[model samples]
Target chain A: MRTFSKHTPLEYAVLYGRFLSLYMRSKMQYKMDTLLTSAAVLIRECVTVVTLYLMLQKFSVINGWDLGQLLFMYSFVFLSYSLCILVFAGVRDFQGIVHQGEFDSYLTKPLNPLFQVISRRSDLMAMLGHGGLGLILFLYAFREAGVEATGMNVLKVVLVLIGGILIQGALLLVPASLTFWLTKSSQVQEVMFYQMRGFIAYPISIYPKIIQWLLTYLLPFAFVNYYPAHYFVGVGSGGDGLAYLTPVVGLVLFGLALLLWRTGINRYKSTGN
Target chain B: MPSICSSLTKFMGYVLSVNIGNMLFNVWTKVAPVLIVSFLAFHLVLPDQAYMIVLFLISLLLGYFVLYGFNLIVWLSAFWFHQTWSFMTIKNAVILLVSGATIPLWFMPAPLEKVFSYLPFKDVYFTPLSIFLGQVPADDIMLTYLTQIGGIAALHISLGSCGARRRRSLSFKEVSESANVQQTYPA
Candidate 1:
């Protein structure tokens, strides 16, 4: 078994591909279950978007955000989240791995534990469901919001989206890493990550000053969508230079998360199951 | 009968656990802090009318029963379907959309609003919220209560009949299986 440290980035990428394909093949064995679960997820996500659309029909706009811009903003959350879960499903479900003593196997292997955890699983259903909705919303809203399909703009959008995905991964990783000390960190992830993300589905400016501050400085989910949407939609205020800082924030937070994960791995003791 | 009682106890325990979780996680972490901050820093004022508060609580309690009935019906459908998660998901999505939890009923399109008015989903969330917001008129409060009560009664009646039918079918299957076993064994 080759140690993970000796493997080049290209080799890691190839291994990741292999692991992903293996999981995908396993998932494909239950085609009906996969389809149904994906459909359920799609419908679940559609409810909020549909509700917003319906509400917009009556109200026209919410806190200076029109339907198109709002959808564009919302697309960021779903699209990035789908990609994030695809890459980080194992981390997000780290509690289950620990509970089942599967983490012990990862530790025993010559491979990096975090890499093993990440490459262990992917939520293809969530990726399909959320990614499909997000693509539809992005395509529709790109035209409706009048965002030009210039090369630079496209590059910027792609970069910002990558940053958003990283931010979401870090959010999941931090709470999951807490499983080293806490028996149940899923609730912490639920409130800190999921619930907090819900607040940023719309403009953070609409929230109270305190919440805005919290999103800006403390949790920093604002960099995920609100900031980038301001740059793309060109309507919201307070994101002048902050819009470009998403990648920086994402990188910094993800780095810190890795540090925390490293510390947690060192502290980890087996569940003795 | 004893089995039914045991299952009922288990169901109640499940409901109790859910409530406890909501109180501990949701109310304690999310709702309480916001409410406290609003009350202290922002000087938020709740409705002063005691009777209105009582009515709101009553409606909320009724709404809980209405939700419980709906969930029980879905849970009982496990007898028919190998997987009921899809049903639960669809049900939850429908409830989230139509119950005025996501968007107020007034904000919904006219036809959708009209359709939702007839749905038990509205009574679960919208009615209680409307009553709390003082949108429901004094004379109409009783009517709203009646509609909620009516929804609960209708759901329970259907569930009771469904459970009876399920029990009968299960017993029939068991008896036939036992009969086959006796024939094969020459008992």
Candidate 2:
């Protein structure tokens, strides 16, 4: 059965694929600079990881969490966040698109703007995020636990990873779509990004009660690593699968976010010349 | 001196106007996390002794103000990437040292915690939360705040001098680029 989309979903997919391929070609056009900057960005991410490890070394535990458990948690969160950034790099740039009147370009193209947005960044970052940190964590966890995590544990970890990515992408949509209302190309985007990072980097247990509630119910950053972490470590089973459902929560939130985005777009449409 | 301070206030207003609303949002994102983490640790980790929570919050804020003040000074100085990283690194270290973000100052040797008490590092992560945790008395709050402000003011002077010196060298475009880079990748 044909969908009600103005541009057939398949047609939009093809167009998006073409756009992404072209975008990559353009990036590759500046091959050396791109390589250098890509490396810089990677190193920056590595520094963040190093901070966590150092914290572990300093006290050997945060709150009550030990090194091994925290490391397991780190692997989950870093791997998940990396995947989200890698796959949804375009989401991060939503502000620029709104500011430059490029959303209009997307609208006129007769595609679901989000699909086009998501698909147009072929996502070298995602591949790196999934495998790069994933391997390191996997090896460490394996060596330390000596087969306690197991194949089934690893598979569940992957599921939790997927959940984390979906929730993260959904979270981006809400703040990103706010550019429609804010109208200024301010540091709000970076601010929110940093806020999320600050909130996510440490154990969720470290936040104030108010913030903990918000992160769990509102932003859902806790689920990215914490829930799945408790599970694989055999400590997560106590009703915390609630954390893994963050992606589902995110999906519903995304639907709501898309509504806001459309409303923002409409506001822009009326305001524009 | 008060007249000079008034002039400085006017100058800062002018600077804020030129920079736009970024400073407000930017400041919130930078400092709010420190507040949140400090407060949370006070409430949760050691809840039985409610008095201790008060002590912890005060201790944490003291540590935070010192580091944040120091950080602003470093940021305003010559644009060295290493210094920028140091600002963040040192700020994190301060938190780790005090308020038990990593290691509790209490767990350390008495002499160490006592030395840290005067050094301003404990002011960042430990003091605010410790005060909130009620580990420290209400009377100590003023002393903590005074010391933190003193540290911050001193560093601000040092940073402002460095910025004043560089004012002649940096062009408008370079200023704009620096601001843009800051907005793009705060991490």
Best by lDDT: 1
How would you encode candidate 1's per-residue C-alpha lDDT over A19-126 as one tens digit per residue? 899988987886765677678778889998998788789889988999999999999988888898888989888888898899898888778889989998998787
Error of 2 at B99 (Å): 19
Fnat per candidate, as a fraction, reads 0.57, 0.00
Q: Estimate each model's TM-score.
A: 0.86, 0.61
lDDT string, candidate 2, B1-187, tens digits: 4544454435444433544465456569766876688778665345566656655555554565566555455445324332233233334444454435455576666786677666655656665656665565668767777877776677668767777776544333333333334434222
RMSD of each: 7.6, 8.1
Against the true structure, what is model 1's DockQ?
Answer: 0.31
lDDT of 1 at A107: 87
DockQ for the candidates, in order: 0.31, 0.06
**Candidate 2 residue lDDT tens string, A129-227:** 344765587568645533365687667666777887777777777667777778653466555555665676666776677877877777777777776
Give the residue spans of candidate 1 off by over 4 A: A1-4, A8-11, A25-32, B1-38, B41-45, B80-85, B168-187
Candidate 2 has an fnat equal to: 0.00
